[model samples]
Target: MTVVPPLTRMPHLRHVLAPVLAALLVATVIAVGPGSSPAAAQQAGSPPVVVRGGGWGHSVGMSQYGAFAQAKAGRSHGDILRHYYQGVNVGGANVPGEVRVGLLQNQPSILVRSSSRNGSQPSAPVKVNLGNGQIDVAWCGGCAPIDWAIAFEGGRWVLKDTSGAIRGEGGGPVTV
Candidate 1:
């Protein structure tokens, strides 16, 4: 069998261990409190000291303050990312032509309302029921309301007009 090098030499392992090592170091320093002997504090039976640290983001990844300082000192986006995250090659990658992001996950339903600009009255709100698979679409402003029935059938949402004809089939988002 061929011999393999240690996993610690891997870039991803190095990146993962660096933060853990830093946290352990900080914890050790705090446990052995500065300006006071640990034995003395234990003998006095004093309460645990609470130490507050600075910065706005979590310590699992790149530090917000560290990135801000780097940017203030004239660092590019790629430079910052490379500095924080190892095993990542920045730039020279193919970019996607289009990106679709799905929002409002786990929401039972959604209510949409029309607005009139410049201190005008708003129209009636339309309710889209996602959990039960039904939608009540509002037609126009100030006219007799026409309700269009839409339901989820066979894993796809089908929109039907007033005459009960299948207009279109969609997944989540519906357009009237």
Candidate 2:
């Protein structure tokens, strides 16, 4: 028999292995469809990939459980708030001004009203109308309307202008 070089000692080993490895990778990808976890796909009556976690409200800022733990560890309420909100002065002061309240409803309008500390006639109710996909800022006693065209880009809401310049962006509730 003619002496043949071993696969490891062959000059074209890389070329021979490249296509084989690529085919294997493609086959593996096809076998495991996108996000098809074995536990998720194999269950007889799985509840559609249910994710379980624990937390209340928006999960932002200080948590109630955290405060309870801190209090149990001999930390006071003031200490807890200070720890949660760093570099912030936690105190109350008396300021004299009319309290303005803006009530935003499910509809695209804000009912604006103001009331003074002392019993006085409340300001006339003003309805600030916001157009569809339009965010307005109260400026110079009028609404400065910014027409936003929002789109889902890269897994987040991207607020863009008519010229496609990104103005603002957020994944959750956007104030502006």
Candidate 3:
């Protein structure tokens, strides 16, 4: 007569049971359908399962190719911008000769020169001359003074301090 060993006493029984349990789990999942597991479905409703689709990148926002097609179909530049950017107004006017913009500390600034005749006559080049000492300015009447410095290096503008350490750098315009 043949004798069978109990599972606890049989060392090879674990190896055989592992594969059987795995196959049973796979079969149960296949029968239950994708994302239909009790835990997942209860945590969040079952989401749609996509099969096939074609897109170069993300689907959010306007497509550049669609904008190009609209332009080719006789839509103006402003029309294209307005369509892609909702709640936006597009308009243009002649440039002005001289315009002064108030500046703030550590903010980027821009200077624009235009030869259009829609505004005041062109004036001499604007300049900001700093002394050899460190720049000292206050934020408010009772605020403490802040020290800064400005210099031009390698065709770019640099803002530094008394220690010659660069605080900010850019080209195009000067910042206070």
Candidate 4:
């Protein structure tokens, strides 16, 4: 299904992946955060965040939905692939071996450890440096604080951010 070749699998995945992957994954849970800037670049007033579509990834290939559309329109696998991945002759070269399965949480555990009140959510999205801060993930003040209570569907630690925490899940502390 996932055409990601094998040469990329590894134990290194656990560490190298957590932070980087968490930062990247966290952006998906909401529409806009505190600021109004795109995530790529930040300014003095506000940081930016771009909302990507089609689940995730480049979305250049046979999107299952797209495939369904094409299939309904009577397109073959080759046609679907061609439509998504431009300029690539597909024959049969060599797809290395790589496939790993792990659970990824849909909601992040928000604690707001320090509660510093990071500022300035202008008329735009804010860019969080998220520097090498310790893994102190907690909900911040906003419409919906990061949902830290809900147990994920699979229990696998999701390496996402507070913004990307589970939808409609954030709120005041989860009282027992």
**Pairs of residues at least 3 apart in sequence or in different chains that clash in candidate 3:** none
Candidate 2, residue 25: CA error in Å? Answer: 60
lDDT of 1 at 54: 35
lDDT of 1 at 57: 43
Question: Considering summed lDDT, which 10 consecutive residues are worst modelled in model 4?
Answer: 93-102
Measured by TM-score, the strongest candidate is 1
lDDT of 4 by residue, 125-167 (tens): 2222222122334444454433233332242223244455542
lDDT of 3: 0.41
TM-score: the better of candidates 1 and 2:
1
Model 2 agreement with the true structure over 3-70: per-residue lDDT tens digits: 33333233443433332333333334322222333454443543322222333563334566777798
User: TM-score for model 1?
Assistant: 0.28
Model 1 collision count:
0
- The TM-score obtained by model 4 is 0.24
Candidate 1, residues 22-131, lDDT tens digits: the string is 43343343222223333443434444322223334434456767877997999975676667665555554222222222133244423233334442344644555433
Model 4 ranges off by over 4 Å: 1-65, 93-98, 101-146, 149-176
Instruction: Select the stronger candidate by TM-score from 1 and 3.
Output: 1
CA RMSD of all predictions: 22.2, 27.5, 29.2, 18.1
| Candidate number with the higher lDDT (1 or 3) | 1
Q: Which rank order by lDDT, best down to worst?
A: 1, 3, 2, 4
Q: How high is the lDDT of residue 66 in model 2?
A: 79
Quote each prediction's TM-score: 0.28, 0.22, 0.21, 0.24
For each candidate, the alpha-carbon lDDT, in order, equals: 0.47, 0.40, 0.41, 0.35
Query: How many steric clashes does model 3 contain?
Result: 0
**Per-residue alpha-carbon lDDT of candidate 3 for residues 48-132, written as tens digits (9 for 90 to 100):** 2222222466343346688679979999766765565444455543322222222232444332222123443323322332222
